[model samples]
Target: MLYFKHYAGALLLLVMVTGLISCRQEEPPLQKVLEVRNLSDLATTEYHITKIVKASDDKTWYKLGDRKILMSVEAVLKAGIDLSKLQPEDVIIDGKNITLNLPAPKLISLNLPPSGIKVEYQEIGALRDPFDNAARDALLAQAEKQIRRDIAATGIFTETENNTRTLITGFLQHAGYNNITIRFSPQTPLP
Candidate 1:
């Protein structure tokens, strides 16, 4: 009986040691390399239009060719994951003729500010019907008020001038604004 007990213990120890040794974790596989011959050749590749803002209208009130044309536009483009397979430095543009070159692309991702404030602006452009300086100021004030109210409704951030600016700056940064400076006073009184 004593000899059998000692052998059983030895066998259990041997099995555990062998099991641990054989159960090594495997390493992850490396990413595959993409083969891109010509970026222009891939002009037909679909691109996602993230945002578009128009700021222009036809202006022809005076004589022939005397009228002016205003233009305001902002657009964001994403090539999608298929383009990710290509080299990051490569550039692709489509028009009458496809243009391809190496251009550094700017990538930006923005998070909503903790304050729950939302802000947006239209692209600049000359307009026939323009707002007066005072009207523009009033518009800005209204916008600020709306932002404060929206944020307050969410109850996410304390109402303070510094916090508002911080939240706005953070949101802009997340939205891919490389150089962003938000300037505004707090609309809501601090709790």
Candidate 2:
């Protein structure tokens, strides 16, 4: 009878210990995570320019004094934001609200269509050299420069900002986030 009593006490102690451990909640690890890397290509523009290239220097050298060539060029300009510049402190998750500071938009790529080049007129003097592939390429480079300048002047960055905000906001909403706040890096003024 005494042995049975000791056995019952041991069982009671075991049950109490198990119940205490089970009632205690485990604390989660202390860590801060704001991992987000979503690089997206957002905007594209097609540009066309008609430019006139005058070979005045060649005129002096080869008697091609009144040479004027007309060239037409078409190119594609792609712009987007690069998320690789995101920093750890740039993101904050608070309840249902997520605030993210995205990097500034940039011009991603420029491509001239294969069959979009047009050389309307190439006037060569009798004693001057013909307009070759090198000359055509140089003119096209000029057109490319002008196209890029025009694209910048037309506020491509603004369009990119709008598109990025819309895209990310929709994404976060779909993921069950109630509020989404996105801001771009401020532009630094040049001296």
Best by lDDT: 2
The count of backbone overlaps in candidate 2 is 0
- Per residue, candidate 1 scores C-alpha lDDT tens digits across 1-191 of 99999999999999998898789753321111123323222222122222211222235455232212222222222211123334533322222222222222211212222233222443323434543445444544544444334433433322233343454345434533455443222233422
TM-score of every model versus the real structure: 0.18, 0.68
- Lowest-scoring 10 consecutive residues by lDDT in candidate 2? 27-36
Give the per-residue Cα lDDT of candidate 2 at 115: 76
- Against the true structure, candidate 1 reaches a TM-score of 0.18
What lDDT is reached at residue 101 by model 2?
Answer: 90
Mind giving the per-residue lDDT tens digits that candidate 2 earns over 12-118? 99999999989997442111222235344444332343444443345365364555577666676667777667777777778778888988777777788757777
What local distance difference test score does each model get? 0.34, 0.67
Instruction: Identify the runs in model 1 with alpha carbons over 4 angstroms from their true place.
Output: 1-21, 28-65, 77-191
